[model samples]
Target: MSKVEDFEELRPLLFSIAYRILGSVSEAEDAVQETWLRFDGSATRPTSTKAYLSAAVTRISIDVLRSARVRRESYVGPWFPEPLLADPYEDPARSAELADSLSMAALLLLERLSPLERAVFVLREVFDFGFDDVAVAVGRSEAACRQLLVRARRHMAAGRPRFEADRQERQRLATRFLDALRNGDVGSLQSLLAADVQLVGDGGGKSPQLAKAVSGAENVARLLGTVFPWLVRIGVTFEPQEVNGQPGAIFRHRDGKILQVLVLDVLDGRIQTIRGVINPEKLDHLGPVADAWAADREVKQARREWG
Candidate 1:
């Protein structure tokens, strides 16, 4: 195959690696572009393009992660991985292990790991790379890479999901959630959410979001029904889509501008977590968003609509 064709074949894999490690779509795209540039200029080609490209993406992502953590330390609100319309990785269905590593919960857990640990985990567990390859990717010796893997696994295990998600069941719950959310049906919505359900919004301070992660089904439902009533109004639209191997939806305003892209974490047949990305900076790649919209519009909209 030609150089471009080879890159195209491995693009999804590379993108998945970078996205999982860096947790930013724009950054992942940039990393992949840089990888291509390097590949284009190289006079020598590796025997296995997949391994070479995967290593390049992994190393690039590790560098990005190291820098991103610094930026996130001072971020405005809770930082969330950029919402994905669809997972850009290996098919989770064909590989259950892949799903575990790419899920939102898993990615969040990964953020707690040091960059090397994260890289080691992604390469060894998620991508099934050999220790030597992982070592090369992270510039560590084989034994050091093995130690990193154990540490990463230990950290990840502490937060590992209780059970594998049932896709049909998760989708059913998400559909019910969207319906109740848009209908302003609090009782029904509450029924579908766990008592300790948590809702986390990422606005990066560029937009409005929960000042902190909101917990409890009542609080989350109240915020939807009373605080942000326009969410249930007729003008808004909801489109069901998969995000990071879980049931999710893309929400848009009456103006057809994307507003929120969300993912639901279903456990025990109810939504245990609700993650929404409303920051226009993150949503702009999906479509036109009011990038300049007021950060506190949730409060203003509530008053304007009610009054």
Candidate 2:
């Protein structure tokens, strides 16, 4: 295949590496574009285009992440990675290795790392880059990179678990949780959640949310129970959709307005973390979920109209 074809074939992998490191879809795309530019300008043909591209993307992501930290430090309220709608290319193997990579809990925990540590951890753990490659990409020696990984691992140990539920089991639990929510069963919600489950909302001060993270399953349950009644009063509905590669709910008001999106992080067959993104800025990529619900509504309407 031509170099152009080769580059096209590797775009998805490149984007995945960048996104995992930077945790921003837009920034990932930008990093990939920059990688292509560097590839095109190079004098020598790349020995392995994939490695070159991955290295370039990782380097670019590290720079973007460093600059992003400056901005986030001054943000209006608590910051969170913009949640992504799950795409077909999500690697099940990578997902399994990095249980919290796509989890809101994992993203929040990453905030504790320095930019270089974040890049190193993502490359080593999530993308399976070798220590040497990671060191090269992050400008560290292999031994130094190994130490960085060790430190990152220790930092994440508090949130890490010995076993994580399979995707099917997680979906099953999420479905049950959503059903209970729709049915107004507070007991069911509480039962599904881990006792210490925490709800972290990222409204970015652009929407309504508790000013700080809400902890404890019972407290989260009470909050959701109270909110659900008001939602029912307003004729709002909940729809199950995949968010950040996990089962989640999108709230749609009667007039077809989407108010919020919630993604759960399941661990050891229990709901351990809940991330609610009500911020308009973070929801922009989600793209008018009302339209998605309307599409479903249209199909249902057609079935009735035809029947």
Candidate 3:
């Protein structure tokens, strides 16, 4: 195949690799585009296009992540990865690993690793790339790459939640949780939540967000139960969707503008964590973002009128 054909064929895999490393869909796309530019400008073709492009994107992403970490140090409120609606690449042999690593929880765990370690783990553990290819991708010797993977695995294992494997069971629990949230049914909501469950938000100081993470099933249940009813009063609606390979929902305004993305961490038949990403900058890729400040005002007005 020609250069264009080979690059296009590998685009999805390249994006997946970059996204895992950087955790930003926009940054990952940028890395892929930059990789293509370098490939196109090269005087001669490499022996393996896959390895060549993968290495280019991984190095670019590692550099981007190093700079990004500095910005995140001063970011307001909690930070979460931009919501990914669907992963473009698929390998039947690695489906389970792909699904597990693409989760919001998994991505956040990966944030604990150094960029090199993260890249090594993604290429070797998640994508099942060979040691030689992994070393090439991250610009490390095979021995160094193995050490990076070991550290990555240790860090990830320290915080990884025991994810529920039954997809139907997860969906069923999520369905009940959403239904209870819609109806303001605190009892039903609490029943589905783990006793230590936490509700957190990432609004980046640009929208409404929790002052801090709210923990305990009762506290989380009550907060969702009270808040969602008011949102419903103002014509906000949520549609269930898969986000980052887990059951989630995209909330929209009455006019259908994007409001936020809510993802659940379901484990052992109960919801363990509830995460909401409401930063407009992080959400614009999904659709036209809603003015969350205006939405807050509308909710307040509706509350006063109801009283």
- The residue ranges of model 1 lying beyond 4 angstroms of the native Cα positions read 91-94, 291-307
Task: Supply the TM-score for candidate 1.
Answer: 0.92
Best by lDDT: 3
Off by over 4 Å in 3: none
lDDT of candidate 2 at residue 197, scale 0 to 100: 88
Cand. 2 Cα-lDDT? 0.76
Model 3 worst lDDT window (10 residues): 156-165
Residue 139: error of model 3 in Å? 1.7
For candidate 2, the per-residue lDDT at 115 reads 77
**Full-model lDDT, candidate 1:** 0.81
Q: At residue 96, what lDDT does model 2 achieve?
A: 73
How much is 108 displaced in model 3, in angstroms? 0.8
Give the least accurate 10-residue stretch of model 1, judged by summed lDDT.
290-299
Cα-based TM-score, every candidate: 0.92, 0.83, 0.98
**Clash list (residue pairs), candidate 1:** none
Best TM-score goes to which candidate? 3
Residue 109, candidate 1: C-alpha displacement in angstroms: 0.4
